[model samples]
Target chain A: MTDNSKTLLELRNIYKSFGPKHVLQGFDLSVAPGQSVVIIGGSGTGKSVSIKCALGLLKPDSGEIYFDGEKQDSAKAVARIRERTGMLFQGGALFDSLKVWENVSFTLTQNQKMSRKDARDAAIETLKKVRLGASVADQRPAELSGGMQKRVALARAIISKPDLIFFDEPTTGLDPITADAVNDLIREQVQALGAAAVTITHDMASVRKIADDVAMLYDGKIIWRGPVDRLDDSGNEYIDQFVHGRADGPIQPSM
Target chain B: MIFNPFAAIGRASMAAFSEIGRLAIFTGRVLLACLTPPIYLREFFSQCMKVGFFSLPVVGMTAVFIGASLALNIYVGTQFGAEQIVPTISVIGITRELGPVLAALMLAGRVSAGVAAEIGAMKVTEQIDALHTLSAKPERYLYAPRVLAATLTMPILVLIADIVGLMGAWMICVAALDFSGPTFLRNVWQENIYENVSVGLIKAAVFGMIIAIMGCYQGSNSKGGAGGVGRAATLAVVGAAVLILASNYVMTSMFADT
Candidate 1:
């Protein structure tokens, strides 16, 4: 697992289960520094669970998570990893109680103890990177449109210029055009920051747009993974069926 | 059929025990977090406003009404000869038992439900998870502020309730029951003031801790969707109310001899 010096994050033989349902079983994946890895999977395929496990939000029953070449097991280790990582939850998960700017600069002000004025300025600057105007900074998340909220969340995720970022369905509720714009923005920001990114998404277009590498998760394991160019011709039936969005292939719709 | 019945009973008992264990552990964690550093002063003040200041009106109104009703009941129950004891009895009852218990019950309905709904919504929307990713401990940032505010504020609320309740009783007795206001006040002040008020305040603090803990425990464990949040709120209110009453009985027993 530590063979590659460039590997920024690795999940080795991870397993997670809730009650009687096993969500992840022996899941394995690795991401290199400055690379964007998009995990593609069908519904209920443990994509979110895997990301949560990696982030220490959910503890895996077995296996280890390596972040920046160090094991993340203890609470101290997890906190250190989280300090350098940013996450974009599927629903934006903006603190409804805080203004948009406050939400964006929450880590900066609360954890880093930055002055409010400085944090607000930094937040506005980050918002601009996501193509949001300064006018929206003082507004609440509910006041923004779905796309605008997504942009705010994106801004919040990258405001600290984290060493690693995780995006959970960044384009789930957006229209195709807005989704494409978000994908483009995410790609541009990740490239500019040169940070490793892990995006879990079911949107094929997003996978195509933001992924340097694509991994398919099915039945609690990564069945196929390679460069984005290899996704269409992965030669794995599960990956082929998923990428093509076909029902007749080896994967039957779970009823 | 026999085995099925036995298994069902065993499973239900185990679930109940597990739930109690979880709540106890959650309460311990909240206490530990309170002792730790990185206290969120802003959140604590906001919670104080929500749990204490904003609840003054409802707690006050309930206290006044209960006080008046208790006075009327005592006047009716007493013979003409024993009617002079009304003021002392009303004051003793309000401060020693009725004031703290009723105020806590009202807050359990109001504040506990609100905390559960707010935190449950946060859980459902992944804000709790978002906080974790931001390297913020939910127990420190969320639970400690709430528990500390509630525990510290409940005594003040009970103190207010006691005064309002006694005033209501005095007003009712003097105006309608042919009693003098000065005489009634004198009787209320002369009868075990320190013992009654102190016991009530102590109970208020303990009740406040229970309310906050139950609300947060149910809310933080909430799952599913809107339905789950609703259930959490309902359970929080019910749990807090029940715990307040049950603990009140235990506390009263302990304070009875004193």
Candidate 2:
């Protein structure tokens, strides 16, 4: 549990399951203002489920998710909470029918009720923030490469200047070089916005690049969490096994 | 590899039922979303144009041929000394039921199929997810406009079908049956156009709702990869067509004299 005052988003004793498969069991996480928390876990470790719960995409069987010191209970309150945050899904999730700028400003145009011309202008400016040229504004996501698509996704996430962001496997299928570039972009944007960030990923390199705080998940719980600099010496066996990318360690793999 | 065909079929049946349950829940949520804030008027109008105006040609063609055939059949029946009742049967058959139901079926094949494919592909590609992330309700952004448009436009399309079919019957009477065009027109207008056209429009409105709901529902609930999108498209057409015909019969019986 956090100190209650300094946290931007907080989850306590979260428990979730799908049928017989228990994906998250008593998972807890606290993200502070302007902090970059990267959650490292293997496949099916409840990372995605945890993020979905916080975003109201999935309801936890039993848990408490707080945003800005307020519980998201009523529809009005939930909408208010969502308005302050942005998300980058595992896939780019761009609207193929919409041009890149339109996709980027979708929130502003649709929710904020801005004019198309004004939203497009805002979108181009946001695109520039992610180091994309204005030319990409008119192109579709299909016209871009994988790396470019990620940048567009990033642009869309940051267009509203959200106070918090959730990145779901931000660099999952990218090449090493592109993945590294994305990691740097994530770090730069989070710092520029001075916003709290929670990223779910399995890439150790990505954690090193983007995370100020690192948390390792295993067997439906947070096995270890600490500052990124202390990751190598977390002294937790699961953390050590995962950080080293080794198959043999004190942590046993279930068949 | 112990394979039981019956077990496989049973599992498939269960999956189908599960899918239906999921769609019912989704429909409830979409209906709720429609009532919430942030009405997308522009999108709704655009979808109306797409579902209504663009679907006329196919529906028109089907209605004309069906009307001509019905007239010919009635004419043949008249030759057997049932001449006095031909107008009544033809008027009730084309305007009261066949025109709207047939037009709807044609639109379901043409419009519903396309809507499902478009929405299903959008679902798979993450456009729907993107909308959600942007704080846009996918239902309002995607479904509301489409459903509303289909509901409003269908009746108009059906009315057009009614007129075209009447024209087809006129051509049949004048050119084929050797009856004067004025007489055929007079008989159609006097005996049929009032009750039949009104009834047809009612059928068109109901059919429109069915087609749009099925199409939007299938597309919005599509799963898996390319194959999932393909299945959604197929299901939209098949489901809309069946519902259109079933609803047509139910409405006709409800409106017809005992």
Candidate 3:
């Protein structure tokens, strides 16, 4: 939990399930303005599900999602939350049908009704911000390599200058070097926008590079939440097993 | 687990009803999106080309062969009787029965399956979710255009099929069956071409909506990964085909002169 006055987004006492599998049980998380909170958890621990719930992509059977410290109880409120936030999905999730520039400026043209020429110029500038060349803008998503695609995806996520951003395993398929490069970009962008962020990733390097605070999820609850510096010494066994990447520990691998 | 036949039947029925409810809701949303302003004409036109233009060759080819064969069969069957009615009967059958149904079935295999696969892949890959985050409504941006295109294009496609089918029947009736080409044309023209063609086009529009809706429904709701997408595509084709045939029968009965 965070202070009510400063909290930007919060999922309070959330409970969710998929058929018989209870994915989130009384999970709670909050992030203050301009903070980057990385959710660290093992597979199927409902890490991504929590973020999805907050964004209203996956409805929680019972939960309250607060955006800008207000309860997102109405359809209008939920839609507004989504309209204001951006996400970088694990697979980049760029429209393969659209060119890189089109993918980046999708929200601009679709949501804001920006003219094509203006949106394209904005897309090119954003691509440049992500270190992508202007020549790369006309290419399709499939034409780009893994790293360049993530940069394009990041460009899309930041183009609208959202006040809140979600990154779902932002560096999943990239090589170590590229992954680190992406993490740096994510860090710089989040800082530059002064936005609140909630990211779910298995990559500790990503955690260290981007997170100001860290939350550990296990058994459908946030077992630990603290500043990133305290992740190793939080003295929580689940955090220990995950951070050290040890197979034999209290945190048994899911069979 | 014990096999309880009654419970199993109940569960199956409930699942079927649930699926029907979901489809109905999806159909309503798609229709609503189609009617409202801010319609994405670009996507609709692109889909028209994809659903209509790309599918023309196959539907047209099927129509020609079918028309030729239908005329041949009618000639053979009528040898002991009114062989002169072959042209009239062939034209009627093509417009009233074969043109709309065959064109629809062809599109079910092509457009329906293609939409399902593409959208299902997008679902699994989180492109749909990405769209949500970007403030784009998936129903408006994705489903509406495809549905509108199919509904608008199927009628035209079926109309073309009817003409091409009549041409095939004419060629066969004159060249092979020894009927005069002018006589064949006169026979078809004497019949109520307006009624039959209109019936077929109406049937086609309904079938088109069915095809696109089933595809969009199965695709957007697909789960898992490649397997889920494959299953969605299969379901789309199957759902569209079955609905098209069933609706064709219903419309035929309603429009029957008897």
* Candidate 3 lDDT tens digits, A120-219: 9999999999999999999999999999999999999999898889999999989999999999999998889888788999999999988988998998
Model 1 lDDT tens row, B140-226 = 989999999999999999999999998889888878887887888888889889899999999999999999998899999999999
Task: Show where candidate 3 strays beyond 4 Å.
Answer: A1-5, B1-3, B80-83
The TM-scores that each candidate's chain B achieves against the reference are: 0.97, 0.88, 0.97
Per residue, candidate 2 scores C-alpha lDDT tens digits across B159-207 of 8887888778778777887776666666766774676788888888888
Worst 10 residues of 2 chain B by lDDT: B79-88
In CAPRI terms, model 1 is classed as high
Candidates arranged by TM-score, highest first? 3, 1, 2
TM-score of 3: 0.97
| lDDT (Cα, tens digit) per residue for candidate 3, span B1-258 | 889999999999999999999899989989999999779887889899999999999999999988988898898888664445887898789998999999999999998999999999999999999988887888999999999999999999999999999889888887887888887888888889899899999999999999999999999989999999999999999999999999999999999982
* Residue B80, model 3: Cα distance from true site in angstroms: 5.9
Model 3 chain B lDDT-worst window of ten = B79-88
lDDT score at residue A128, model 2, on the 0-100 scale: 88
Q: Rounded to one decimal, what is candidate 3's iRMSD?
A: 0.7
> For residue A174, what is the lDDT in candidate 3?
95
Error of 3 at A31 (Å): 0.6
> For candidate 3 chain A, which ten residues in a row score worst on lDDT?
A1-10
Query: How many pairs of residues collide in each model?
Result: 0, 0, 0
Which candidate gets the maximum lDDT versus the true structure?
1
Report RMSD for candidate 2.
3.8
